[model samples]
Target: MPNHPQPLRSDYKYLQPITTRWHDNDLYGHVNNVTYYSYFDSAVNTYLIEQGGLDIHDGNVVGFVVSSACDYFASIAFPDRIEIGLRVGKLGNSSVQYELAVFKDGVEEACAAGRFVHVFVDRASNRPVSIPEPLRSALARLQA
Candidate 1:
């Protein structure tokens, strides 16, 4: 397997707690690999909506996820309280790369780490657009 660099809790600027659902586990009894991506999406979107003032429903511009990746370091089962640690890995004119980590609550190390890239675009034309001032300022605070 290719070696993926593991991240620590302190590496992130924002953290959001998540409660694992029973359905998140796979037949093997741990969180399904696909669920990690869901956690990443939830955390990033929560930050964008709450901190960046993104109007997902009626905004002229919205962010579309263009790429994502995850690496699991350990297993996490249902009923476990988790926190998604998030930070901006890169901020560009039209795109922002978010790095995230899933950690069991109170744990210092990550159980899984991932990256998601969002490209800002005009909702009507679906064309690329520069990130808005409010969103850009919010993203800058989390830059790593």
Candidate 2:
């Protein structure tokens, strides 16, 4: 096996709790790979809604995911209470990179680590725009 860099909870600025479903497991009895991306999307967007006050349906500006990648270090199964650690790796004029780590509750090492990039753009025009003040502030708090 290859050595993986495990992430700790202290490394994250925010967290979103998640529950695993039976269907999340595959024949090997662990969560499927695709599910990790779903968790990544949920945790990041939940932060935007709960803390950044972003309106997903009617916002003038929306974030479009342009790039993402994942590295899995461990396995997670159904019935696990997952705690996702989120932090901002970088923020630019109209883009942000979010880093995520998924940990089984009570564990110190991340079961998986991934990143998502969002380009802030005008919803109607689909052109890049400055991140709104509230969104910027919220995102700043997550910066490492």
Candidate 3:
């Protein structure tokens, strides 16, 4: 498999720092494949809460993951601080595609990169809804 390309820190408008746990590693001594997705989730959600004012608990609109993809270029181990980069790719009426790149501290290259798509839906009805104004504004700032 080919590794994901790394984007420069200046290229991304938002970033979130993540700590890798011991269990995040697989028997092969590198971070497990699944853990990267968790980091992507955290990074994106954190940005939404801080920048988009997303209310995960009581918000009328919620995002559901409809698709995800990742490409690993290097190995990252436990105790490393992973700096996750985020940018908005496609902002649809009810969905947003977030691109993420994970770097092992200070590294200019990404150890892994991928995308996560969230479809906004009404919390009560579970039906698709347009992106709220506040959220849309926040997301637009991160457009790549």
Candidate 4:
């Protein structure tokens, strides 16, 4: 595998604060690896809902995650205040690739970085659909 350097907070376009929960820690005492993915999902979806006007419950279109990945440079534990930084790496007709980084509060560098790909699809039919204009415009602001 190639060595990927951790990113700095300034590398991202948006930031969302997330509080680590007691349940997020594993027996090893660090935040479980799986939880990082949840953070990624939460940050992305929150942006879509708040800025893109995504109506999760009744919208005609919904985003389905098609791929995801993460790389950790350091451990995070419960009680840590985390800030997830988000940016758009690629935006397509029906899919968007979001690049994310997790920074421990007050830290300048990210402890973890990742990417998520979401494809917009028809809510009922599950067929891929073009990204709506409003959402596309909002996502464009995140481009880095």
Alpha-carbon TM-score of each model against the true structure:
0.97, 0.96, 0.95, 0.98
Q: If both were scored by TM-score, which would come out higher, candidate 2 or candidate 4?
A: 4
For model 1, residues 1-144, the per-residue Cα lDDT tens digits are: 328778899999899999999999999999999999999999988999999999989999999999999888989999999999999999999999999999998899899989989999999999999999999999999999
Overall local distance difference test of candidate 2:
0.93
The residue pairs that clash in candidate 1, if any, are none
Ranking by lDDT: 4, 1, 2, 3
Report the C-alpha lDDT of model 3 over 1-144, residue by residue, as the tens digit. 664456666667888999999999999998999989999999989989888999999999999999999988889999898899999999999999999988878888788889989999999999999999999999999999
Report residue 3 deviation for candidate 1 (angstroms).
1.6
Q: Candidate 3 has what TM-score? A: 0.95
Off by over 4 Å in 1: none
Candidate 3: stretches off by over 4 Å: none
Lowest lDDT 10-mer window, candidate 4? 1-10
The order by descending TM-score is 4, 1, 2, 3
User: Which scores greater on TM-score, model 1 or model 3?
Assistant: 1
The deviation in Å at residue 118 for candidate 3 is 0.5
Candidate 4 per-residue lDDT, tens place, 1-144, comes to 327888999998899999999999999999999999999999999999999999999999999999999998999999999999999999999999999999999999999999989999999999999999989999999999
Candidate maximizing lDDT? 4
Against the correct fold, how does model 1 do in TM-score?
A: 0.97
Name the runs in model 2 displaced over 4 angstroms: 1-4
The candidate with the higher TM-score, 1 or 2, is 1
